[model samples]
Target: MTASPTAIDPAVTGRAAALDWVELSGYPTRRNEAWRYAPHKKLAELSFGPPVALTTSVPDLGDLIPALDGPRIVVVNGVVNTELSTMTGPTGLHLSSLLDARREQPDRLAVHFDRVKSQISDAYMALNIAFGGDGAVVRVDAGATLEVPIHIVDVEVPDETRNASCTGVVIELGAGSSATVVETRIGVGADFGGSNIRTTITIADDASLEHVLLQNVPASHMHLSNIDVTQGANSKFLARSFNLGASYGRVAYRVDLAGSRAHADLSGLFFGFGDQVLDQQINVVHSAKNCTSRQTYRGVLDDASTGIFNGGIDVLPGADGTDAEQSNKNLILSDRAEVNTQPRLEILADEVACKHGATVGQLDESAMYYMRSRGIPAVEARRLLINGFADQVVDEVSIESVRTWINQRLGHDDV
Candidate 1:
């Protein structure tokens, strides 16, 4: 007699071993330091089951690509969809799929993939590595300057059968090279049936990379993303992230300046409405001399939504003459809305300049009253003031179209 679905005994196979680790690492309480503040009880308890076979072909690339010019890579459900992406550069700039790269350059992939060694003791990170399916592989040539940006879109399509954890992406920039990357996530409706995604990036000596992350996933779905990067000598990296969707979402980022004269600028904006819960954690590590880093994050919390921000900077013992600063400012638009902001700095070096501070409050009563007294309505005045407060960080984004989109979403365009 044929065995029933549940009658089949559980077997530990190749990928099953990895899934076991993922499940164990996702436990809410013990052995998972990365999930300390942002527990995955809701996401972990749900039975996503096994990843099913890929059925749908690659989606159209027309809407995914930005209007501007640059290279492009499209990853759907954590797997690279080659038909939807573009790569522009000389032969030295290797833009290939993760599977192709793994087959061709196993040694390089082994060294660069999941090489971030930190004591955060994050179990999810290892789980991500072990279960990573396929992702984009971008390797810039030494001294090559990618004049335009690289747009990477990781979209989650609604599924009728199983929920999947999509692919991951890993990028490596060679010495003296430069590139910009834009990552966007899209989901339809309030369906809790989609994919979870995680990604990582690395920058080499004298390399520079600017990364923009946009999240507008389904309101009912859940996404937990983690990104880690390393900057070499004279390398510079800028990260601008926007969180706007999902009932529960959290993104953790870590950047290490391991070479002299490296620099990093990390900034983020989050909008929490409804019962959404969004959390962001960032860690900047300065391991060499003459490194500089800056971080700024702002958020708008409405309804009963809650947001959390924890920014940390660590200057190692031998790292001298470092300059670092971190700031987090939040605005609560409703009485029940809540925001938790924490900015911290740990420096062991004797010679350095660093500062960290955070503030959480509502709209200024005096300013609001003054605007109301002038002829502006209460809603308009509040919107104007809030937009102005967040404008400084938005202005730092290099992409004009993205900036415009962000502004429009924040209701600042009309104001």
Candidate 2:
């Protein structure tokens, strides 16, 4: 039986009032401009109500935690996994559970929680804030540089009935602090459908944060995520995402440069095969003087898969001396594959230098021909060219081991 919307826990009732706001805000129907390119059938029809809490043994998640060697935290089905997680951090780093942290550290929660709006009226984002019960609260103390990256992985365990899960994460990076964080979503074999909703992150002044997301959900799953970040004065933030699973998935990533001399970089890659659909929307807002931003997204669509990229850069009035650039590139390896991209720039400050561009096409025929001329097979030739195209972005990852792992995952035989 499909769960009802009222299935939410009564204990979180008052706090759950936000879920109603998400539904009432607006459904992304076919007519909606923002969602027109990406259909919301599963999202609109799925029973996204809360799941019934039950005691279940935590299954073994091998090697996932060690991948994040630094201080880390793990959450399974929306609850913190203490056994597999860690609390040791830099002197300024504060890590705690959302519920317990709020009770004990209300000031920190009050300062950063929900500071970014779902004002864009995204249904999934609103629902997350309303119904999400358990989550992580992270605070990077000023001038503290963490030696390791924080790894957060959300897994959907096998179950007999279709289930809905919501997880929330709040990361606050203080002035002059630097850290790296990786978020991964994995799906196990299950008889029922799985749906997920998660939301917001905040970066403070002069701090630096490298955020990476890896999603490998099952083909029967439906996932939607929205990440909003606020950059303080002189801060630098880098955001990278890899989406590789689910029948339908959408991610809305937004960054607002609210402090002067701050900067933000956004990069992402998506791979979709079979009947999968992956939609990625990125928006960077420059609201302060001398702030800079850049965005680049690449996608590989195979079989009958489809993907979309809408990246926009907005420089507000009085935010002079801003510099922003945005680009979207796609590789379609199959005739039946499809991809659409929208790269937009809204500049109100005349003193700023802003540019945007997009390209949609097949593999480089000439480059493939050159490789084939060397007696290379057509399939292998195409793979070589595609690998070269994607390597530029993969090279940006700093960790040698992680970078090597990512390259191997992308089917690259050589560095």
Best by lDDT: 2
Question: What is candidate 1's lDDT per residue for 1-415, written digit by digit as tens?
Answer: 1232122222223235444554655444534343454645666643343233445655554443345566677666555666767865545667877756766776676654434334223545544555555567777888888767677777665455436454567788988898887787765444465455556677888888988887767786776677778889999999998887778777788888999999999999888999888888888999999999999899889999989887889999999999999888999989989987776678899799999888888999999999999999999899888888888778888988778767776667832
Q: Could you tell me how far off, in angstroms, the CA of residue 313 lies in candidate 1 after the best superposition?
A: 1.3
Q: Stretches of candidate 1 above 4 Å error?
A: 1-39, 46-66, 88-92, 114-121, 158-162
Model 1, residue 7: displacement in angstroms? 25
Q: What TM-score number comes out for model 2? A: 0.90
Model 2, span 1-415: residue lDDT tens: 2233344233344334455565466666768655876656656655554543424677667633226567767667666677867867767778886656756765656544443344545666656655566567778888899887887777765365466567777888878899888877766665455546464677778899998877777777777777878899999988888777778777778889999999899888888889898989888999999998989888889999999898888989999999999888899989999998887778898699988888888988888889999999998898888887777777776766556656666678865
Tell me the whole-model lDDT of each prediction, alpha carbons only: 0.72, 0.74
Model 1 scores a TM of 0.87
